[model samples]
Target: MAEMTLHTELPADMTDTRGLPGVQPEHGPWLRVDEAYAAQIARRIALLDDVPEQVLYLETASQGAAQELLHEALNIMPTLGFTVEGAQVTCPDGRKVDVSSTAPLEALGRCLQNDFVMMEKRGDEHVLTGAVLCFPASWSLAEKAGRPLSDIHIPVDEYTENVARRVQRLFDGVQVGRPLWRFNQLWYQDAELHQPRSATAPLRVGSNLPDGPFYRSERQTLLRLPLSRAVIFVVHTYVLARADVPELR
Candidate 1:
C-alpha cells in the first residue's frame, strides 16, 4: 500500500489521473510547466523519432517531473524503431551529424535511446519515466531480426531484478520495492519444473517468492522461458521531502 502520509499540498492546475503515468492527465490539480520545461521538452523531442506506437512507462516523485518526462518520451517515440536509419543528431558543440542505428542502440544501452528519462518540476521535484516501443513479441521485426539465443524465460526473480535495478537508477534515494502484477501464463519446457500452470495452485500475492529459477522449494509451478527477454517492467516514485505526519483528525 502507498504511504498515505506522503500527500503534499496539491499544486495549482494539477489533478490526478489513474491511468498511464506518462500521459497528461486531462482532468484536477496539476503542476504548470514553465518556459524552462518547454525548452527541455523541445530538446528531448528533437532527438526522437517520428513514430507513435511506443509505450512509455512513467512514474515520478513529483507531478511536474512526471509530466515533463511524459512529453519528452512522446517527442522521441518516432525514432525508437528500425526506421531511424539516417536520423540527424545534434552534438553538444551545435554540430549536426547523421546518426546511425548502431550509435543510437549503443546510446540506448548507455541510457539515451528514448528508453528512460528523468525530469524536474520546479527545482528538486524530480520524476523518472521509461519508454519503449511496445510491440508484440512475435510481431516485432526487431526481435525477429536479432538471432534467437535462448527462449528460456529468465527466472522471474532475475528478470525483475534486472529491470528493478535500472528503475532504481532513475530515483536516486528511495527504498524501491519490486511488486509485480503477474497475469496469464505462456508455454514452458524445462527439466526441473514442468507444467502449464505454476506449481502453486493459486499464486498468492506478496506470498509467492519472486518468480524465477528455483533452489529447493516446492512452491514453484511453471517452468518455461518467457517469449521475450524483456517481460515485466518496474515503475517507481521517490521523494526527498521530510516524511509526512499523520493527518490531524
Candidate 2:
C-alpha cells in the first residue's frame, strides 16, 4: 500500500484494444505505485461487504496462505501508515482494523486496494485456492475457486497455445524473493472498478467506441510466499476516461 510514484502523472500512451490477444508478460512483474489513492482504496474496501460472493472466496487449503498474506501486507504497507498492535491494524487515516476478528482473507483484502488471488502448486499446475477479487476484469471468483490455472483461464482466447504453458512455467520458476508483473489493457463501456462480468460478455471493439467511455488496464503481479510455497497474484485496476486516453480517439 505504499504510495505509487509511477502513476502520479497520468499515462499518455494508453491503448484501446478490445480483443484478448496473446499475453506477453514482462520478466520483472511487480509494479511500484508511487501515488496512493487512499480515498479510492477506502471506497472499494467499504463496498466489499455488499458484494461478498463477487469479491472473496477461500478453500481449506488456502487458509495458511491467507494468513501469511495478511502478515505480509501489514509489513509492507507501513508507508501508507499502518500500525499493527497485536491483532489490530490501524490505518493512516485512523480507521482501526481488527485482523483477528475478520477472516484472514477478508482482512487482507480490506487492507489494500489491489485484489489478490492465492495459488497453490499441485503437481505441475497451480490451483486457485483462494482470492479476494473485488475488481474482476471479466470473470467470476466463485467459479474459478479450486480450479487449476489452465482451467481457470479456459475462457481466455489463445490461452492454451499462447499464455497457459508459459504462465505455468513462470510460476514454477519464480523464486521467493523475486517478483514480476505485466499489464493488460482493454476498453470498457463503463468505468466502475468492481466489474464481475462473465467471459461470455460481448467484446467492445474500437468500432463500438461510442458506447465505451472508459479505457481499462490492470497491473498484475506475481509473488511466491517463502513458507507456504504459494503464489500471490495481485491485480491493481486502473480506469481512465476515453477522452483522457488519446489512443481511444
Candidate 3:
C-alpha cells in the first residue's frame, strides 16, 4: 500500500470534482494530452521500455484488450495533436512514435499518457490481469499483477471491512457505455510517480509533515470494453507542490 496522509478536515463533498482549487477539470479524468504537456508525455513514453519490465503485465487472455486499447488510443490521439501516418504516430512536438516494433500492450502504453489496467472477471471476482502502470503512486505493479480486486486492495486500511463488497458489486454491475470516475488525494514526501515500497516497509497512515512536500492526486476512471468484456481502469496522476495546495496552505 502507498503511504497516505489524511487531512484533519475532510472535504464537504468527497465526490465533488471542483473541491481542489487551481486544478482544472478540463476534459475530466480520461484526458487527452495536448501540446502543453507534449514534452513530458514524450519523455515518459520514451522511458516506458526502460522502466522495470514488471511495471507492465499482459496475460494471454488480455491480448485482445491490449490490441483494442491500442486502437482506441490511436483513434483518440488525433484530437490531441497525435496523427497516425501509416504505422508511425507523430506527436504534437514532432516526435515520431513507431509502434510497429513493439508489442501491442507496450505500444499502447507508450502512445497514451494515461496508465491503464485491464481487469477481467474470474469466477466471482474481477482480477487485475494486465496493466501498464508507468506512474504508480506507492504500489508495485509487479506485486499487484494477476491478483483479485479484494486481494489487490487488501492492504488499503479498512478496505476489506468497508468498501470491498460494494466495490465488487460495482464492478459486477458496470456495463459498457456507462463509465464512472472518482478522485483520490494523498500527501507524499516526493513527487515522483513511481514509488514502490519494499515488502518489509510499514504502511504509514498520516502525513510525514514538513518532509512531505508533495500533494498528489489521481483521477481514476472505469469503463467496460464492449468487445473484450474487460474493465479498463485509467489513472491520471497529478502532483503539486505542498504549498500550492489550498488545503495544505
Candidate 4:
C-alpha cells in the first residue's frame, strides 16, 4: 500500500472510545497540522489528481454549501500555518493551491490535511451531500456518499438503531459556534493512508490482537456552518508504529 506514511508518534492525550460525543468540545481552529502534514497533504493532492471521482463527490443541490465550506476553510486555515492571499493558499508543505475553483470541494482536497465531509439535513435524517475523503479508514465514499447516517454506517455493529436516533438528535442539537469532537483508535497491520474498502466486501482489520504493527486513529470534529447550517465533519487522521504509542503496550 504505497510505502507506509505515518507520524512518528501519536498525539499526546489521545484516547479511544466510540459514538457521537464518543465526543467532546472542540476548541477554536478546525484545521490542524501534525508531523505527517507534508506527506499526508501530498498524498491527498495525488489522490485528487489521479482519482478525483473516487475521493470527491458533490451533489448538485449542495453547491452553495460546498462553496460556503471553501470560504470557511480559507478563513480558518491561515491561523494554522497556511498562508492565504487573494485566491491562493500556500500549504505548510510549500505547495500553493488555488483557494477558488469551480470545484470547491476539490480545491479543499488540494489544500488541507484533514478530509472534509459536508452533511445537510434533508428530511428526517442528514444526508452525505458532499465530501473530499482521501483517507477513509475502511469505508468507500461511493457507497456512503448519498446515504443517511444509519445507512452509511450499516456495517458498523455499534451504530445500533437506538444509537442512530441519538446521533441524529446530537446532529440536530449541535450549535453553529460550539463544535464537538471525538477519536476512535484501531490497530492495523500496515499504515496505508488511503484505505477505502467497499461496503459489500468483508472487513479486514487488525484489532483482533491487543496491538499490531501500527495504530491508526482519526480525530473527527463536527462543525455547523453559519451560512448553510450544514454540518461539516472534519477527520484528521493519524498513524504511527505500534511501539510509538506507549499506552497500547
Candidate 5:
C-alpha cells in the first residue's frame, strides 16, 4: 500500500458560516457527524491535520501520471455527489458561524468508488499509489435511491432483532453504498411478482435496508444493491488493477 498525502488551504474571506442542526436523537445524538456531508468534512479535516495521513491503498504501478489519476478522480466524484462547503469561526463570546455548502460527501463516495488516488512517475514504472478512502453508510444509498424522509418504515415496536438478522444475512458479503433503484424497480416489475401464484414478493426500499457499509469480503464491498423489489441490497466494488485495464498501445 502506497500513501498519498493531500492538503488544501483557502483565504479567510472565502470561509462559510453556517451550522447544521445538531443530531438530537430521541435520547442522544441521532446521527454521527451530522448527515453524510458533514461526516465527510470532518473526516477531511482530520485527515489533513497534524502529521496528515496519505492514501495508502494505491499500488505503485498505478502512480505514473499525476494528471491522469486526478482527472479520473474528478470524473468519478459526481457519481457519489460530493461537494465542499466553506466554514467560518466566530469571536470569543460570539457563536461560530458556518457560511458554505457543497455536497462533498456524495462526491467522496463516488471518488472512493473509483478508488481515487494520486500516482507519481518513478523511473520506468508506476507502483502502488495513494488514495482517499471513502465508504458510505446505508442512509447515503437510500437517499441516492430517492427514498424520502417519510419513506422510512418504523413500527411502534422495534424490530432490531429481525432487522439485524435479515440485514446481516440478506446483505452478507456486500459493501453498503447506493441502493439499486432501477434494478429494484425492475425486480418488482417482474411477471412473477405480479402473479397471484408467486410466493416471493418485492419489498419497499426504506422498510428493509438500514444505513451502513455491508462488506462482502476483505477487498470487495457492495457499490450498488440488487434490482429486486427488496429495499435491501448488497453491491460490491471490484478493483481492477492496471493489468485489468486494456493496454493503450
Candidate 6:
C-alpha cells in the first residue's frame, strides 16, 4: 500500500488555470528538500527496493546522460544543505547515500525528492529514454518509456496537437544550465505519491473534482545536458490536504 504522504503547502503558485506548457524561466534552486523530504525519501527508497523494474529505467545508450545527471545533482544539492564527503552524500534528513557511478540514477533517486527523467531527440521528437520515476501522478514508466513527448501525454486530454508541437519546439530550444519550469495542480482523494496508471486502463477518479481531500501539485522543470544534449525532465511533487492549502497570494 502507498503510504499517506502530505506536504504543508503548495510550493509554487496555484492560482492560474492548468494549461499546456505554461512555462517560465527558472532562476532559483530547482531541486527542493521540503518538510516531506524524510518521509518522501523513505518512500522513494522503499519503492526502489521493492519495485526496481517498475520504478527505474536506464537505456544502455543513455548512460552518459544519467552519469551527467548525477554529477549535476551532486553539484546542486550541496547548496541546499546536503553534505558531500568523498563518495557519500549526507542528506538534510541525515541519511547517507553513496555516489554510485554504476547506478547513478538510483543514487539520485535515494537522495533527491524530485524524480528525474532523461529525454533525448530520437529522429524528429524527444523520447523518454530513462527515468527513476517513483512518484508518478497517474502514469506508468513501462508504457511511457521510449515514447516521445507527444505520445507520453496521450492520456492527457489537454495535450493537443498544437501544444505538442509547441512543447517539442520548447524542448528543442531549451539550453543547458538555463531551466524552464511549469506547475500543475490537481485534486485527489488518494495522495499515496506512487500513483502510476497504465495507458490501457482508465483513471479510477477524475482529477478535476470540485472537492477532494488532497491537493497534489508537480513543479516540473526541463533542462538540457551539456554533453549529451538530452533534456532532463524533473518533477518535484507536493501533496497537501485541502484545508492546509492557502488561498492564492
Using TM-score as the measure, the top candidate is 6
Question: Cα lDDT of all candidates, in order?
Answer: 0.25, 0.70, 0.67, 0.83, 0.25, 0.85
lDDT of 4: 0.83
Off by over 4 Å in 6: 1-4, 12-14
lDDT of 1 by residue, 184-218 (tens): 22111111111122322343222143332211111
Q: Pick the candidate with the highest lDDT.
A: 6
Model 1 bad stretches (over 4 Å): 1-50, 55-63, 66-89, 92-114, 117-249
RMSD per prediction, one decimal? 19.5, 4.8, 6.1, 1.9, 22.3, 1.7
Tens digits of per-residue lDDT for model 3 on 68-115? 877767876777777898779986767677877777777766676678
Where model 4 places Cα greater than 4 Å from the true spot, the runs are 1-4, 16-21, 209-211
With a 3 Å backbone cut-off (N, CA, C), the pairs that clash in candidate 4 are none
Tens digits of per-residue lDDT for model 5, 32-133: 111223333444344434213232233333333333433333443333443322233231223233322322222332223222322222332221133343
TM-score of 1: 0.19
lDDT per residue as tens, model 6, 130-233: 99999988889999999999899996888899999999999999998899888887788777888888888877644677487888888898899899998998
Candidate 5 or 4, higher TM-score: 4
Q: Model 6, poorest ten-residue lDDT window?
A: 10-19
Cα lDDT tens digits, model 2, 141-247, are 87788889988887666576557777788889778877766557666766566667665667543223556766667777788898999998888777666555554
The local lDDT score (0 to 100) that residue 99 gets in candidate 6 is 79
State TM-scores per candidate: 0.19, 0.81, 0.81, 0.93, 0.24, 0.94
In candidate 3, the residue pairs with backbone N, CA or C atoms under 3 Å apart (3 or more residues apart, or in different chains) clash, namely none
TM-score (C-alpha, index-matched) for candidate 3: 0.81
Question: With candidate 4 superimposed using the best TM-score fit, by how many Å does residue 184's alpha carbon deviate from the native?
Answer: 0.8
- Model 5: number of clashes? 48
Off by over 4 Å in 2: 1-36, 200-211, 246-249
Report the candidate with higher TM-score, 3 versus 5. 3
The global Cα lDDT (0 to 1) of model 6 is 0.85
